[model samples]
Target: MNGVITPADTLGTRLTGLRGFYRAGYRSVLAYRADLLFGVIGFVIQTVLAVAVWRVLYDGHDEVAGVASSTAVAYAVLAGCIQSVVMPWQFSSLPQRVFRGQIGVDMMRPRSLISQNLAQAAGTMVGRLPIGVAGLAVGLALGGVQAPRSLLDLFASAVSILLGIANIMTINLLVSMIAFWTLETGGVMILYRFASAFLSGALIPLWFMPEWLQPIIGRLPFQAQIYAPLSIWFGTRHGGELIGTLALQLGWVLALFVLLQLVWRRAVHRVVVLGG
Candidate 1:
């Protein structure tokens, strides 16, 4: 049973397993209604602060760092909305899963362990989507997200948003596998998030940064994950540039998954996270 499993066999088994795992993750998140409520509350508070920041900057300059007033507000609203689309509920959750021995159990599966976890993590995203959608609608209505003038633009926006999520989920699975070697999950999570927020245009739009910072920021993959897509919707980057942005996102998704396979193999061979 061990050697050279066929691709067809591998796929069929994985699909069945993932379906169950995904549902379980959904149920698990829903069971903790308090957490979802608190998350919503926090998001609301953050949205208000973000809107205030953008408004002040826009008022001062007519354009905040060369970005239109409407675009800046949309950025803030999208940042809030995008928060729920990402995977890895909390950075520490991965280490906690390992410390409790879930990693070992996950490793025992016939399918790619990363896919299994990702599918489950996706469920959590789906669970949060409804409330997050409603919240984003409310925030945008109050804060003013620029509406797409055309159906094509709207469709593109939706595609970019989902692909952005896919790109994020891929990166976090790679990050989570770090629980295999070091107990410093907090540090890894913090660094990953900080880099993403700042460079990815969530914390501040790249337009707001000095010219010197813009080049440095553009080179990083972080920008491609979220801001690049959002930029397309904002019409800051259009057509081929937008297509290229999505290509980069897909590229990252593939590259990160391959890199994660290597890490998972090594961690499975060496690390011993008891019970998790």
Candidate 2:
């Protein structure tokens, strides 16, 4: 009995522990219900403003940069919802935890620091699910959003959205880990937000960008976050294109995972030597 492990004692135990972390993360967000409400309101307002601006810009034009007015509006609305799920602020406390001498306590936990941070982020996203749903509903009611053209489109869009969340989380974790090298990560955070928003199509669909810029943006992981998902939902990407986009997202997730592992190892070493 001491040497042999049953199924329940291995996989089951790990699952239970992960679930506990998730629930804790979920409750943490719920503890700030007022902030959640305000966040939803602000997102809705931004979506509405974007829709209005795009509609006016496309008033007499059939298409702008190969994208129809309807498609652009749909992209804008859905992009807003997707952005809500990929929140970077969920892990903003990592640097603070490091600075406040709490990392030592966290390191003592049985679970890996990355796993705990990920569980918290996942829980935060789950807690913010209502906000995303509300934003989608408002988008649909506003009469600009288009339904998924086909079943494949819907499925691919869903998959891309999930992958996008994972990609965003890994990126945030990588950024937070920079705290290990430098205590001041404000500049890094600010730059990441600006670059991600612009490059990810949260601010503008990549399709509308200049032809020269398209190729450059396509190579970045940012487009896979909001642009690819919205593009699928709007029925712009079909068959091979849809599959390729998802594959790209998968690649980014894998790459970022490896990066996180390498960075985390070095970070732990630094913490140990510094006695913080």
Candidate 3:
């Protein structure tokens, strides 16, 4: 009886292991102070530019397509800062680890690779939170960001944003799994970035898209990443519409997580390292 591991013990052990990985990831961000400094600076610049661009676009126009200029600028700034933290352009080192035969070490660990990866990714996101906050501050100072419509909307936006981050992480892990077969994901990652940036509304909200293209993008899972949360933040989709958006975002997160697990299983079996 003393030796038997209870369910609670197992859960606790897994959580502990995930916490260690998360810390490692967070520390990795701090390992390079210069890089972090420059990265934050660049993010601020990007956020300022986005704010400027939106302001210029909305110049002399109070409202365009049912969205006020202030709302549009606010959305652009918030969306840009969010994207800077969440949808980083680089594919994770998972692909490289697989290519270099280092994935075996990760696979041999007691914890599942997916959990470790997700924990690390979450830690990295948290570590970079300051950058987003700084950029958001700049936007707010410049009158480019607007407060949430209300406390309820703010709460809903928070939940939606969490779900959106989960959605993006799962999708990223799924794409990284491609390295199991191809061993190189540069071109694929570039395509993924462009598709995600545009389809996810990181560049421009779906409201600005052509009517013909709106339906197609809306049907895809990308909209759940950035658009849903920001839409809630800006109160563009309220009442039943907000509820529906959150439902769809939650559905995508759950669906993508399942799909990621399935892909990871297949990818594990396909892993073959020669002469390493």
Candidate 4:
């Protein structure tokens, strides 16, 4: 068996390589600490402004769509924090790589492209933690935010947030893959930003949305990314409902994974045909 790698050994090696990629991603983010700090400051400002707007809207009302004004403020804060941490908009470098003719070199690497990108995304999320925590603290200080109703709710929120981050990353990967054919993804990126902000409930909770629109938005992956987790934190979703929501998030993650694979294969074929 000397100098021979078994299947298990190969799997272990690949896992180790992926871990390295994750660490590299984390380090890269850390290297831009100043930029991250600025981002945190901007995020805190945005969260505060959002909280103020919602507070004003609910000034004369106890609740809107069964959610208290205070709860809405909390949701706004938490949603902003999640967005800043995951920062899905920044996840995809594939477009730039394609534009610069560097994607060919990336494709030549032995690593699985999806796994490597996922690792990097995981790293970026890790790197954003300090900023996220700071932003959350600021949101709390600004008032109108509430603590999780119970330990269980808190746990559920945490789990949902992790799933949400995964969902966001998958969506970003899918969007970036479009570069394989178009080679210019600026418009697509802009469209994704607007769509995600609205549909993900970052700007407004789905509960406040039109009743007819609620069902449609609920079924979308965007809701899984932000709304579901925030709902868990706000105690709006619980027990079987909480379980169902988390299940939906998991389903989206799996579905997106399969879709990414299919799209990546076609993208690679396109790249090859274009002489990449």
lDDT of each residue in 125-205, candidate 3, tens digit only: 877787888899999899898999899999999999989999988998889889888876999999999989999999889
Residues 1-276, model 1: lDDT tens digits: 578799998778778878987897688778989978787777777777777777876785666456778788877787767765463346324577676766666666776677777787888788777556765877766856777766666777678777777777777777877877776687778888887778878777777788988988876667766677677777765678767767777777677778877887777676543433
> For residues 22-52, could you state the per-residue lDDT of candidate 4 as single tens digits?
8977887789889877877887778778888
Model 1 TM-score is 0.86
The whole-model lDDT of each prediction reads 0.72, 0.85, 0.86, 0.86
Instruction: Tell me the number of clashing residue pairs for each predicted model.
Output: 8, 0, 0, 0
For candidate 2, the lDDT comes to 0.85
Please, what are the lDDT tens digits per residue for candidate 2 over residues 44-149?
8877887899899999999977788988888888888878866645454579889888999989988888988888778877888888888888888899789898
Better of 1 and 4 by TM-score: 4
State every prediction's TM-score relative to the real structure.
0.86, 0.94, 0.94, 0.92
> What are the RMSD figures for all models against the true structure?
3.8, 1.8, 1.8, 2.1
* Ranked by lDDT, top first: 3, 4, 2, 1
- Which regions of candidate 3 fall more than 4 Å away from where they truly are? 1-6, 272-276
Candidate 1 backbone collisions, by pair: 98-276, 99-276, 100-275, 100-276, 101-275, 101-276, 102-276, 103-276
Pairs of residues at least 3 apart in sequence or in different chains that clash in candidate 3: none
If the candidates were sorted by their TM-score against the true structure, best first, what order would they fall in? 3, 2, 4, 1
Worst 10 residues of 1 by lDDT: 84-93
